[model samples]
Target: MKKLLAAALTGAAMLATPAMAQADEGKIQFKLLGTYVMPDGEITSVNTDIVGLPAGTQTTASDNFVPTLAIEYFVSPEFSIETICCMTQHDVDAVSGLTGAELVSDGKLIPATFTAKYHLNAGDVKPYVGAGATYFWWVDAEPGADTIPLGVTRTTLSDEFGFVVQAGVDIALGDGGMGVALDAKRYFVGTTARWYAGDTLAIETEHDLDPWVLSAGVSYRF
Candidate 1:
């Protein structure tokens, strides 16, 4: 009887281990993520006047695989708050009636979001959707002609507010609370792109700069 009881108890202990692990995995956690954004659109300055030099199209771009980080905490199984510290440096280029110029605008952007997440039934794969807001400030832009001139008050995006929509999924790890996840978000960053030389201000275009973000990383549930 003692030998039989010992074997049964060991089997029971093994069964309870995985169940306890799953329950503890529900705890809130943090993650560090990296992202790469590919810009596929153009921000242009249009000519309002029927005469004079025509306005031009300027392209903004970033180097491959920009570095970023994300942290997440769950208030409940269905809700969470997340924040990211990521920045972009765009090379600005223009060509207007055969006249060409270039410059750079670099800044750090922080996105803080509160989201309502619905976990899937399958514990191995969890997919969720979220919506939130964002704020971006033009931290530094080079001082030069043809670029957003330095210190032009409100001409550049000193600090602007916007909205964010995101989606992602988390894949479970090997019998652990740590796993991999993929996320993507669309940010509608309201812009204030201005051009003025002397008294004439060109089209004061408010940019609806919508950028797409894609990222993947490992996460842990504490």
Candidate 2:
């Protein structure tokens, strides 16, 4: 983690040293984009006695494809603050690692994020990098009727705070006011999730909700 931060700061300093011209200072940019989220980890269950499963039961969440938006305010041609938002619903299915049986057939996850980026604008091509935090409004899972009868009923994820890193490039579509952008963000937020059967607590454990979000779309500068 320390190494990563050091690398980012070094890169930013190198980009900032050229005394580049600032043509787009104070402009607001908006992007309408299609985003795809690929989650690359699992959620594990610890107290399996409540669910009748063994220890270390890992569950994998599904990927998401949706439309999203980003609003940015350029502090200067070399820097900007942006917020990315979309209300997305994801279905989560939990498969027992040991038995390979599908446990929770139904579940959902929702999230939103904000960022501050530094842009290295070199004429028609703009390359940028950023770091920020993410706030998850909702994350939960519920088992099917068959699983409820087996003592493992539902799972709920606590709201979490995580760090985010982003890197992307913007290509001029025509002139200064329009462009096409491509970016990717990695979120490092993993929190403990809980599983329950009615009023009975089933399992409590941590899971990596860390996801890599890739986006591409059109941006307009005003």
Candidate 3:
């Protein structure tokens, strides 16, 4: 029994060594970070529903304004975890062609995401790239106004699971444990558009998020 207890104690003590090594490796101190994103282009899609509807009814998708904010934790010299939260407003143009009219639908606060990243450090200028999964919860949405015959607005965009890829580099500061970093990335975001007037209208669309995000900011090493 004593031998077993000693062995367990030794094992537990051994576990602490890595944490101590990491602590000895030290970490960066931080508070807040900001980022700005630009879409490679206006994301748009044209889709139509056939079978139940009369025919010739189609919807167009468009988006505007891209921005994101991230707070980072440097777990090691080459790894870190991060959360990216963003917002966007979209304009949907629907035309029946048969009815000879159009309805314009607008604005929504989309589902946001939390992600973990692996940072790669190189030279005095550290460069890193990695991937993470994100989940979005939708908020603040409204359907389009009447601009056509029986024209209903698109209210919400549904997104399930998504894949993200990232890349960035950092420049070290002479003192104060502070440095400047430049980062960029594209997230393959996915979602469904939901429409309703008294009945349910749903169609699958591609966000083509392939956003071209760029940011320059300061980081602190604890």
Among these predicted structures, which one has the highest TM-score?
Answer: 2
TM-score of 1: 0.70
Task: Note the clash tally of each candidate.
Answer: 0, 0, 8
Candidate 3 to native Cα RMSD, angstroms: 8.9
Can you tell me which runs of candidate 1 are displaced by over 4 Å?
1-22, 39-41, 44-64, 95-100, 111-114, 143-155, 195-204
Model 2 worst lDDT run, 10 consecutive residues: 17-26
Residue 121 deviation, candidate 3, in Å? 3.3
Please report how far candidate 1 places residue 154 from its true position, in Å: 12
Worst 10 residues of 1 by lDDT: 149-158
Model 2 per-residue lDDT tens digits across residues 172-208: 7765578898999999887566667677777676678
Error of 2 at 25 (Å): 7.3
The TM-score obtained by model 2 is: 0.79
Which candidate tops lDDT? 2
Candidate 3 — which residues are off by over 4 angstroms?
1-34, 38-67, 93-106, 145-149, 200-210
lDDT of 3 by residue, 26-85 (tens): 464342345554433122453534214434455544545454456677767667777655
Superposed on all Cα atoms, the candidates' RMSDs to the truth, in angstroms, are 5.6, 10.7, 8.9
Local error of candidate 1 at residue 220 (angstroms): 1.2
- Model 1's alpha-carbon lDDT is 0.61
Candidates, ranked, TM-score: 2, 1, 3
Which pairs clash inside model 3? 27-222, 28-221, 28-222, 29-222, 111-137, 120-128, 144-153, 158-192
